[model samples]
Target: DFRPHDEHYVQNFVLVTHGLLMRIFCMCYFRWTVLEFDQVWNPQNCEIWVLEKTKKGRYRLAGSWQEESKSFGPIKFGADKTKLLYPHMKESTPARDMVPGKPGWLDDPALRHLVVAAQFGKGIGVNKELGSLG
Candidate 1:
């Protein structure tokens, strides 16, 4: 059983496979327009949370999963709203990529590898989660 974001509107993802296995991931993006310009910036990130199933058949957040790499750097959830400390965030956060355009998960080699491994282990199809996100 898979719960789509639109249907739940909770800005969360619940993926259940092979009956007993359940994985929860959270992805969110938002944009804001400033002044009279039509231009807007969208930042997005995916959060893989540790979900524990309750006796009542409900899921609860335990914590989040973080991956750190000395070769590359610490994996990020993407440019968050806090990055908007200035009117021109593009200049301030040149290192961070905006979401809906650059998915950090797909861009980072380590993150990509983790996703692929999870998919393979769970017997999930290719880009199934990506399609849902997009």
Candidate 2:
């Protein structure tokens, strides 16, 4: 649920299942569809995606810079003004965590790449479970 105005609208992101810890990150990209989407949000509408590309799932809504990622301390996006690194941001806090409306460059792949690279410090570590987002 990463949608700002509509909290319970957007569904599915990252599902990290390491050993017994199955963490759900709404910032990560989807590995696929159907099962994963339903697991994230039961009775999810395939007609509604995240921000843009409704049928496309906005797969990489967060950012894609985890191709060559490394290990880091406990993941936490502390004191991030734009909440670029914040975990489960859009779902955590609507007013603070997310931008009011969709920006013009949101769908731009090149600009998106730059933004994602700048925000993610060490890059996404759970790219295995989540899609590459490239």
Best by TM-score: 1
What are the per-residue Cα lDDT tens digits for candidate 2 across 1-134?
Answer: 35657856654444333311222334233222211222232112221222224444443233322333532222222223233333332232222221213444334332233334323433422121222332
Overall lDDT per candidate, in order of appearance: 0.30, 0.30
Question: Local error of candidate 1 at 15, Å?
Answer: 4.2
- Candidate 2 C-alpha RMSD relative to the actual structure: 16.7
lDDT tens digits by residue: candidate 1, 28-92: 11111111011112212443434455565454434335545212211122123121122221111
Model 2 misplaced stretches (Cα beyond 4 Å): 1-20, 25-75, 78-116, 123-134
Error of 2 at 70 (Å): 33
The alpha-carbon RMSD values of the candidates against the true structure, listed in the order shown, are: 18.3, 16.7
